[model samples]
Target: MAEATEKKAKTKKKSANQTLVIVESPAKAKTIEKYLGPGYTVKASMGHLIDLPKSRIAINVEDNFQPEYITVRGKAKLLKELQKDAKKSDTVLLASDNDREGEAIAWHLKNAIQDKTEAKIGRIVFNEITPVAIKEAVKNPGEIIEAKVNAQKARRVLDRLVGYNLSPLLWSKVKNGLSAGRVQSVALRLICEREEEVENFLPEEYWTLDADFVKGKSSFTAQLVTYKGEKPVLKSESDVNNIIEEIKNAECKVVGIKHTDKVVRPKAPFTTSKLQQSAANKLGFTSRKTMQIAQQLYEGVNIGTSRVGLITYMRTDSVRISQTALDEVRDWISKNHPEDLPAEQIQYAVGKGAQDAHEGIRPTYVTYTPDSVKEYLTRDQLRLYTIIWERFVSSQMNNAKTRTTSAEIQAGDAVFRVSASKIVDKGFYRVIHLLSSKEDSTGSLPALKEGEALSATKFYPEQHFTQGPARFTDASIVKTLEEKGIGRPSTYAPIISVLLDRYYVTRVNKQLVPTQLGRMICKILVESFPDVINETFTAEVENDLDSVEQDKLVWNNMIGDFYTPFKNRVDEVMEKQESVKGFLDETTDKICEKCGKPMVKKLGRFGFFLACSGFPECHNTRSIPLAKCPMPECNGEIVARKTKGRGKEFYGCTNYPTCNFISHFKPVDQYCPKCGWFMVEKYDKKNGSYKSCINPDCDYLHSVTEAVEEAQKEALAKENQALKLAEEASKENQD
Candidate 1:
C-alpha cells in the first residue's frame, strides 16, 4: 500500500511541472518558445479575446459606468483552446505587449481562464524579443497592472459614448451611415478649415532679381537682398524691371565676406511619432503602413535558424535607451570606426508628457545588421529595419561639422548675397545620409576678399506668386497632432485611417484634401458640438486618460465629467438642429424612368446620386452622369460607378449591356491634343491631377493648369515682340 501511494505522488508531480504561455500574436509566441525550450506550451490569443458588444452601449451608467464584458464574437474556439491548455498546466504566463491595450488584453485573458484551472497566472513583458530578454522576463514575472488596464478601458468607454450617442443624431440631421469619433472629428475639422483657406486665398504677384558674377574662372549667382541701404520689396514686375535696368551695366564687387563653423548634431532615436513622420517624408509611406511594418519587426522575424525581434517596442514615445544597449552600440562604433565615436556616451532627453515605459525603437541586436538578415525579411520589413538600425546607431555617434561662407556682393544700388556650406566632418551623417531625402552637399566655394572686384556677367528677373498655406500631408498632420497632444503613438495611425475610410479626407498629391461630403459633415459637427470637437477640450481629455494610467484620477469620475455635459449638448443639438437634406439637394432636369417624375440630385454616403423627387410614389435612384462617353460609335453617356467590394470610383458607359466601356480615370469634356481622343483626369498621390488621352496607343499627358498657362504665355510674348518691331521700324523711318 505504501508503494502504490508513492507511485501516484510521482505521477502527479510530473504532470504539475508543465507550463503554458499565452501572447497576443502567433509570431510572438513562436519566437518566445524558441527561447524557452521544452516543458512549455505556447499559444496566441490573436489580440483581445473579449470586449464590449457592438449592438448597443454596454456601459451601466448607474453602476459607476462599469462596462459589460462578454466573450468577443468569433473567439469561442480560441478561448476553448486556451482553457483546455490552462486546465492541464500548473502555471500560466500572459505575455502581451507592454502597453495599455496589451495590459487590458492580459487582464481579460486572466479572468476568462482562471475560473477553469488551478494554475497560477502571471504577466511577463519585454521591450524586445531577444533570447536573453525573453528568458529574463520569464524568470521575473509580475501581476497585471490595474492602472494601465483602467486607462485603456476609460478611453474605449469615452469613444463608445460619443460614437453611439452622437452617430444617431447625425443620421437624422444629415445622412445615414455618417459616424463621428472623438479624435477623428477634430482631424476632419482641421482638413475642412484648411480647404476653406485654400479656396479663399488670393495670390499676390512678387518678383526677385538675381545677378551672375565672375571673379576669375569661377562663377557664382547671388540674389538681390538690399537696395539703397534698405531691404527692397519687389511687389510687382515693374519693380523687378527697374532693379534689372539698374544692375545690367553696373560693376559687381564683393563687399562683405563671412565664414562660420556650424555643427549639425545627430537626431535622437525613433520615437513612434518621429518614426511615422520620417517614414512618411523619406519613404513616401502613410502612417498606417509604417505602423504595420513596425509591428512585424517588433513581434519577431525568422532570421537564419533563429527567430528574433528586429526592433524594440515601436509604439513608444520615450527617447530613452537602456545603459546596456548604449554600451554595446558604443563598443561597436569604437571597433568599426574609432574616429566617429564621441568622447562620452550620449544621452537623449525625454519629451514632455512621455510615458517612458519602454525604450526607443532600436535593433534588438547590434550585431544583426540589416544587410546580414535581408534574405529573411520582406522588402518593406527590410527597409524599416534598416532605418531603425541606422537611426539608433547614429544617435550615439558624434555630431557632423560644416563650414559655411556667406558672400555679399554690391552691384550699383542693389546688394546680392549668397551662402554656401561644405561638410567638414561626416560623423553621424555617414549613416543618415543614406536615408535622407535631400543631398547635404553645398559644393566648394572659391575664396574671396571683402574688397575684391567682380564683373557682372548677366542680370535676370523672375516673377513669382506668393503661395498660401500648404495643405497638410501625412507627415505634417502627424507632426501637428503630436505638437498639440491630441493623440498618442497608438492613436495616430487609426485616427488618420478612420478619416480616410469614412471619406472625410482623400489623399491627393500626398496631401489631405477634404471632399464635399466631408465638408458638410464637419460644418454640422463644428457648429452643433463646439466643445466636443474643440482641440483644447480634446487634448484635455487625452491628459485625463494619462492621469488614469498614472493612478492620479479615477476612470469612472473622468468619464462622468465628460459624459454629463457632452450628453446634454448632444440632446440639445438633436432637438434644435434642422435636416440638411433640403439645403444639400438640387432639382435636376432628367425625369425618372419608374414614374416619369423629375429627379433631384441628393448626397449619399458614397457621393451625389439622382433620386426621384416623389420618393414615396416613385422609388428610383441612379448614378449621376460625369461626362459624355468617350467610346466611338456609342451614344451612351459616362456615369460614375464603384467597384464591388472596395467601393473605388470609376466611369463607365450608361449602356453597359451593349457598349461595355469603362475607365478608372475620371472622364473630362476636353479632347487630347495629340490623338484627338477624349481626355481623362488622372490623379496620384505624387501628382495632384493630370490629363491623359483615352487611347492607350497615344502617350500624351500634361498637367491641367500648366498646359493652359504655357499657351497664354506664348501668345502674349508674340504680341509684345510685334509691337517692339513696329516701334523700331517707325524709328528707322524718322531717322
Candidate 2:
C-alpha cells in the first residue's frame, strides 16, 4: 500500500509540469502521445465539445446573426474533465485537423478551458501525425487563425438559417418531417433532372460494319469508318444490307499506314474529391465509406511497436506536397526504381478554386510501403493506403511512353481503319499499374507496304442504339459536384448521406435514382426557391465563404447579404405554395378489412403501402402486393419491405408471420423455363434490367423486355376474369 501510494504520487509529480496536447480523436491523441513521450499528456476532445444544438436554429438572426453555441449534449462531463486537466498543465496546445473546421475546433477549445487555467494557450497543426512532425509542431505553437474560425461560423449560421426556415415550408407545403439543405437539395435536383432525361429519352437505331481480315498468319478485325469519301450513317437494316451488298466481293488492300509515339503523364496525387471518386470507381466504395476508412487511416493504425498515421490529412483539396515528403519519395524511387525517377521535381497545378490548405493526401513516410505494413492494416485500410502511396510516388515519376500504329484498308469505295498501341516504357505505371487495367491493345500484324493485298474472311454488320446520358453513380456524382463547386471537401460524403437518410434518393444497383417523393420535393424546392437552391448561386456562395477564410470578406456581412432575401423567399413560398400532401396517392381496388372503404396507395417513410381511404375514422395500413407467391399451394402475395436498421429494400410474402417467402430482388410474375421457379427482376448499369431465378441451385436468366411483355398479357387476362366474377357477386348481393 505504501509503494502504490508513492508510485501514484511520483506519476502526479511527473505530469505536474507537462504540456497538454488536445486533439479531435482518441486515435490521433494516442499516436501523438507516443511521439511526444514523457513531458506531455495527451487527451482527445472527441471532436467539437461545443456547437449549435440540433433542437433549434440556435442563431440570433436579429443580433447580427450571432450563433448560440452550447456544450454538446452528453459531452458536458467530458468538457469538465478537460478543464480540470487544463488547470493542472503548464501549457495547453490545441492540435486538431488542418482545415477550417479544425481551426474552429482549436479556437473553441481555448475558449472552453482558458478561464480554468493560467497556462499559455496556443494552436499546433501538422499534415501527418509522425514523431518528427508532432515534436516540431510543439516546438513552435501559434495562435488560432480568427479568419478560419469566422469562415466556419459563417457556413454554420448560413446553413442553419436556410434549413431552419425552408424546412418548415417543406413540412407544411409538401409533407410533415420533410427537410431541405443548402447543398443536398442541389444534389437532389441534379439526380431528379437526370431521371427526367432518362425517362424522356428515345433511343435511335444505328449500325456498324466490320470485316475480319487475314494477313499471312495474322488475323485482325477492322471497322468501316467511311464509304465513298463520306461518313457512313446506317440507320436501319436495309442500309446495312445495301452497303454490305455493294462491297461483299471487292478485293481488300492496305492503302495507308502511319506510326507515332505518344507520351502519357501520371496523374496528380489524391485530393479529397479525387480520393472519393477513385475509391468509388475502382474499389466500389461509397463516398461515405471512403471517408470513414480514410479517417481511420489518417488518425492512426497499429504497427509493430507503436501507432502511426498511414496517410496525410484526408480532407484536403490541394495537390501540394511538402519538400520533405517529395525528397523522401524521390529517394525511394531512385533506390528501388532508378529508371523511373525524373531529373527534376514535379509540381501539380492547383485547380482554380482549391483550398490549398494542406499537402495532398499521401503516406507520411515512404519507407512504410503497403506491402511492409500489410499485416497491421485491415483489408480496406490496406487498399486505401496502397492507392494513396501509388498516386503520390507516381505523381513525381517520369512520364510513360507508348507507340501506336494506324492502318487503313480500302475495299471498293469503303474504307476501314484499325489502330494498335504498345507500351514502350512503364514509368509511373510501375507503381500505379496495379489500379489500372493491364490489357495490351496490340494485335500482332505482319509489316506490309502501302497498297498490299489482304483477304477478308468474313463481313458482319451489328445493330446498336444510341444510349442516353447515364444516371449519376457515386463516382460520377462526386466528380460532378467537384467540377461544379457545389460543396467543399468536408461536405461531399455528408451531402449524399443526408439525401439518402431522408429517402430523397435511393441506390438502384449503385446508381442514384430519386424516389417519387424525392422528385416532388425537388420540384417544390426548385420552383419555389430557384434563386437560392440553384447550382450557380450555391457555387457563388461557396466562393464567398472561401473569401471569408482568406480574410477578404466579413463573415457577418456575407450572411447578412443572403439572409433577408432568402427569408423573404421562404415566407413568400409558404403563403403561396399549394399543399401536395395527398397529390401522389393512388386509389386502388383493395378494400380495407376494418372498414368497407376502398384502400389507396400512399408513399411513406419506408415506401409505398395501402392505407384506408377513411383515414381518421378507421386507420389501417398494409403493404402493397407486387406479385403472387411462387410457392405451391401457398396462396400468398409478395410485397416490398425494408430491413429494419439499414432501410435496404427487399421483397417478402405479405403473409410474413405465416408464410416465409422472401427475396432480395423483386419477384416478377414470370417463371423460369428451365426450372419452374419464379424469376426476380434485377438491374445493373451494364446490363440494364434482366430476370434471374431465385433458387440457389438454379441458373435461369433472361432479358426483362420479353418477360415483361408476357407478364402484361397474363395480367390483362386475369383482370378480365376477376371483373366477371365481381359482377356475379354484385348481382347475388342485390338479390
Candidate 3:
C-alpha cells in the first residue's frame, strides 16, 4: 500500500504539469501540436464521442423532450483514450469547429471527460489553423457556449422527431425504405414541382429579326426593337417577314445615339453557399464535393516545412471580412497590383440572420499564392484555392469602368437598335477576366450624326421557342435554398446528398431530376403533411433554431410546439392511408425459370429490380439489363448498377467477377464508325446531348473534339461577322 501511494503521488505530480488539447480531426491535431510544442499532448476526437442512438428516437418526449445521448457506436474506445489522456494532464482544451455543431461536440467532450480526470476543462476556437492563430487561441480560452449547444440540440431533436415519426408512415403509405426529413423533403418538393412545370409546359414559337447596316467605314448589326413608334412583339413568321419586306427596301438613317459610362462593382467575397455555387459553375464540382475539399483546406495542408490551413472556416454565411484581413489584402494589392487598389478599404454587408462568428472564406496567408503552393495541393485543391484567393483579392480592388453606346436606326416604320460596350478600365476585372467567358468587344458604331444615311447589307430572321423552367442544378438549388432560408451553410451539401442517396432525385446533365418514385412520395407528403414539407414552415423552424442559439427561445418548448401537431398528423395518416408497399409492383413479361411464374418489377432501396412473383417458392432477383457489353470477346450484358453510398448510377457488365467492364456513362447500342467501339451518351448543360466512343484510345473521341471545335467556330463566326460588316462599311465610307 505504501509503494502504490508513492507511485500515484508521483503520477499526479507529473500530470499537474501536463496539458492536453482535443480537436475534431487528426489533421487539425497534427498542425496544432506543432504550434503548441512540447508539454502538451494534442489528440483528435474524430467528431462527436456521444450522439443520440440511431436505433430509436432516444428522446423523452413527455419529459421536456430531454435527449438521451449515449456513447456513439464504435466511439467507446476513442472516448476511453480521450479520458486517459485527460487524466494525465492538468488542463484539457476542447478545440472543435467554430459553429453550433462544433459547440455541441465540445460540450459533449467536456461532459464525457471531466468525470474521469481532475483536469480543468475549457474551449478554444480558431477560424484558421496557423501558428499565430493557435497560439492566440491557447492563450485565451473560453467556456463552451450553452446557447449554441442547445440550438444544435434543438435542431437534432427536431430532425429526429420529423424523420423518426414520419419515415415509418411513408413506409406504410408509400413504399418500404422511403424516408422524410425536415429540410430534405422540402428540397424534394422543389424538384418535383419543377419537373411538373416542365412536363406541363407548352412551347410557343416566336421570331427575331436582325439587320446588318453600314455606318461610315464600320459595319454593325442591330435588332428590330420598335415598329410604328412602339416596341414590337413578333409572334409569327409572317409578322417577321412583313417587317423584313418593309425594311429591306426602305432607306435607313441613324435617328438617335446615346453613350453612358458605367462602373461594375466586384462581388462580395465567398460565403459557403456562394462558394458551392461558384465551384459548381466554374469547376464542375458537386456541392458535397465542394464541402469535402473546403474541409480539407480548412483543416490543414502540408506545405514545404510545415502544415498550414489554406483558408478560413468555409461554412460561413457572412460576407463581412475582418478589418485586419481587409487591411492586409489591401496592402498586398498596393504592393503587387498598385493600379487595382482602391483608395479605401472595401466593406461588405452581413446578410440578415447571419451568425457572423467568422469572416468570409479567404486564404489564411496572402503570400501563399495558388502557384506558390500548387505542388503541395491536389488539382482540385489548387482550383478551389485559386478561386478563393482571386475572389478575396478582387473584392478589395476598384470597380471596373465601362462605356456603353446605343444607336437607333430608322427603316420605314421599324426601329433597329444596336448596343455595344467597351472596357474603359480593367480594375478588379484584371484578375477575374482570366476566369470569365465574356470577351470585350471594341466594335462600336463609327462616329455617327442624327439623320445620317445608312445602307442595309443583310437581313436575318431566326425562329425561336420559349423554354420551360429549368431543373435545379447543385448550384441553383443551393442558391434557392439559401435565399429561401431553408438550410444553412453546413446543411446544404448534406441535404443534397441525402436526396441523392434516397433515390428521390437523380442528376442528369448535372440537373436534378425527380424520379417517378420521388414525385409520388412528394405528392403524398405535400397532400398529407403540408406543414412539415412546406418551405415557409421549414424556414420558420430554422429561424426558431437561431432564436434558441440567441437565447430568445427555449429549445424544448420549440420542439414540443412543433411535435404536437406533427405527431397528430402522422397518426392520422397512418390510420387513414392504405399500404402502398406492393402498389409499385408490376408484372413483367419474363417468367421465372424454376417456377414458371411471371416476374414482377419492384422498387428496392437502390432502384427497380426484377423479382419472381412467387417470392418464397422461387426467390430470385436480377438486375435489369441496359445494354450489351462493349468489350471485345465479352458476351456479358451491361446492367445498371448504383454506387454503394451515394447511389449514383453507372453501367457495368453482368459478369462483373469475370468481365470486369464498367462505364460511368450510360452505354448506347450504336458502335462508333471509326473505331468500332460502343458509343455512350455524353451531356453538357450548354451543348444539350451527344454520343461519344467508350474506348479512350478511339478516333471517334476526336470527332467529339471536332464537334466542340465546330460549335466554337459557330459562336466565333457570329462575332466575326459583325466585325466584318463594320470593316466593310468603314472601307465603303473611305472610298
Q: lDDT per prediction?
A: 0.87, 0.88, 0.88
| Residues 13-96 of candidate 1: C-alpha lDDT, one tens digit per residue | 776677899998898888888888988899999999999998899999989889998999999999999999999998899998
Best by lDDT: 2
Which parts of model 1 are misplaced by more than 4 Å?
Answer: 1-13, 433-438, 591-599, 611-622, 629-735
Query: What C-alpha lDDT does candidate 3 achieve relative to the native structure?
Result: 0.88
lDDT by residue (47-160, candidate 3, tens digit) is: 988999999999999899999999999999999999999988889999999999999999999998889999899999998888888889988999999999999999999999
* Collision pairs in model 2: none
Deviation (Å) of 687 in candidate 1: 10
- The TM-score obtained by model 3 is 0.85
Error of 1 at 641 (Å): 5.1
Ranking by TM-score: 2, 1, 3
Q: How many residue pairs clash per model?
A: 0, 0, 6
Q: For model 3, how big is the CA root-mean-square deviation?
A: 11.7
> Candidate 2 versus the native: TM-score?
0.90
Provide the lowest-lDDT 10-residue window in model 1: 432-441
TM-score-wise, the better of 1 and 2 is 2
